[model samples]
Target: MKRPLVSAAVVATMLSSAVATQTYADDALVVSSKIDTEGSVLGQMILQRLSAAGLEVEDRLQLGGTSIVREALLNGEIDIYPEYTGNGAFFHDMTDSPVWHDAQQAYDTVKAKDAELGLEWLTPASANNTYAISVRGDVARENGLETLEDMASFINDGGDYKLAASTDFVESAFALPAFEAAYGFSLDDDDLLVLSGGNTAATMRAAAQQTSGVNSAMTYGTDGGLQALDLVVMTDTKGVQPVYQPAPVIRRAALDNHPEIAAALAPVFESLSLETLQRLNGDVAVNGLDPAKVAADYLATLED
Candidate 1:
């Protein structure tokens, strides 16, 4: 079933009412976030679990980019949502230095910055959202190409491999340029197929489905399909990409009011290994299950 679209004015009204209700209820938190099929899978899970914990959840959601969510948090329109640490480093303008390798350092940097915005970043789930490169299982098995170091040798020795990458990968400071500089393998401009905006999942699935264009793609490290399509992630033997973990960020007022909220959701973080998260992502993103239900069921499993 589709959720009704709530206008900005309606959300504003709801926020006001929720704020007033908070005085009486004392456990209310307004979660504002994107409603896209991709983001909703993750957002709805957190929202649903938080609501089930007796927090009065006002889902005054919207379909927008991360910038919109960030602005909403700053304006006090929303109290909490899941956020990525690298997004804080790059998009939020914290530091130019690559700090993704150190999870604790990244958390500290983001926490310090969020304080300026009157926000607090809770402990992050154990998932790194770093950029990755993947090759078809067959190619990997046949050539023993399992890591970026292997791929660099293959490419340098004139291996017949092509790559499909997003425009972002082509331009991101941490994506392709870093790979080239670290490995000393320059792709013939013709060897790369640039997708206007699609990321790794689309390219990976397409590669699995067909043996045309490119044999590899640029992807996120924790993408669910890497194993599903029998694709092998070429290890960043040189360690180029940065770490990105998903975390809950809340308004300071909300945290102060309901200090136990983090503990309630802490179990979800405790069991979220890379493989576990990938299976969950496959269930919601690939198999098309309701994210809220998946999140709820997974949370329930934690109690078992």
Candidate 2:
């Protein structure tokens, strides 16, 4: 999800023309990004909230990856898009930096970088992108394994367990490399059951529900099944992965036109807890409900 960020030249035009039009009511700001089911639902929720606040959504372009969306932002093709904080680190080549510990640091770093490009990084939500190794609750309880460190020594001492991992896990700094370095153990090729082309949630569900060859799978900490199927996400005692708080990044000109946007959005997105996010994700990803309807219902609840 990498792309050429927007340049200052494009943002200058947007700012210069913003002050001239009283009839620009129909001149809706554009928002565009990738279309990952659960993740997209959250982004749509943000869009829905903004639209309800009388912001015209001239168009919504559900693209394939953040790469194109970022490029669009940089060239003034789009005004805003949902961005993850860790992505800022990766895109800015600060992947190994230790400054990004919380949402605040990530926001500040992205804002500083984007400022040079005439983009503004806004407040982040409570959701994160931490990785976890999930196992069925029954299997974990039976084997007395509660965390990655706990399972590591067991696997090291000749326990036969197949690990289901994404293809990216083989090389990603935040994926397999970090896990092995933190746990002091490694999985042999035979001990690994790799699933290519599918996402972590799909792998986790397959491992949890079906009789997959692998009993354990790599996943995110806030996956819906972690509770539904009574799965236990092994703890990372050694912090090896980077923080990934999801936040809205907008062009500076857009924020200037809608200064109240962040205050309105902050109250709604900031209070979202893990349980709430998982359940909301389940509504659309599992139950097949329309994301707009789900977002509408959830936003209504905030008023109560």
Candidate 3:
């Protein structure tokens, strides 16, 4: 059988395309995360899981804060990283919207919105690491407080209520003020011990020690020290705070290049419930274990 004649230019173009495709496929994916304990843990999990799937990956974990990491992803400086579904409200300037309070709705909204920017939101963990108000275990039990509403009522009835929190949490309109408005209670200057930085560890510790009469602290739902420090997280019964479920957000091009990325990570994230994430974060933040080692140990449990 005779093959049709091909011109030299056509052959050269075909060869160039093949080389480009090959080079693209051979490129190493850069995985990064925010400089936080949970970020490092999630980043390590992604790096290890992708490597196990026989894909080339670069470790850029613990890169920086949310803004820095998010910008890197947008500018193609990073290929993938862990992010919260709730932050989409801020990213898209929809903080006033109520969708962020719902897990599936927030995920869907962000996933759909980011698609236009060539980003993909993978399956999120069931954990909601949102802004939380935690009280000392003894205080919670004594006051019969289980939720923010209960705390509000307690405070309205002249209960002792001092909160240790970061300046950002204390001042942010969307944070403390939103809670106050939703739950119908306010904290005066004497009612708060505002810290300098937004480290939940410091706040939780202060509350644990009753620093400046602070029996309560601003915390995230999945804070590691909650259980270890005997702090009980007051439930946000009215869904006042946005849901911050961690999930891997990737550049669409990277996923297209490696379709297996989604399947490789789905079960891993699916296993991370609120309690599971708190325990994992505690393993590092409380137990002083290495984040990489903690990720490795957890991943090992999922093996067949």
Whole-model lDDT, model 1: 0.72
Model 2 residue runs over 4 Å out of place are: 1-26, 100-104, 140-147, 153-161, 171-174, 210-213, 222-230
Point out the worst 10-residue segment of candidate 2 by lDDT: 17-26
What C-alpha lDDT do the candidate models reach, one value each?
A: 0.72, 0.71, 0.88
RMSD to truth, every model: 5.5, 5.5, 11.1
Q: Rank the candidates by lDDT, best first.
A: 3, 1, 2
Query: Could you tell me which 10 consecutive residues in candidate 1 have the lowest summed lDDT?
Result: 1-10
Q: Write the per-residue lDDT of candidate 3 for residues 1-304, one digit (tens) a residue.
A: 0011245466455445533453223489999898888999999999999999999998888876676677668867689999999888878878789999988999999999999999999989988899999989998999899999899999999999899999999898878999999999989999999999888889999999999999999999998888888888888988888888999999999999999999999999999987788888999989999999999999999995
At residue 266, candidate 2 shows an lDDT of 82
lDDT of 1 by residue, 116-209 (tens): 8789988787776578888888888889997898988888988888888888888877679899889878887777877787556677866687
Backbone collision count in every prediction?
A: 1, 1, 0
- Reference-based TM-score of each model: 0.80, 0.79, 0.84
Candidate of highest TM-score: 3
Q: Give the TM-score ranking, best first.
A: 3, 1, 2
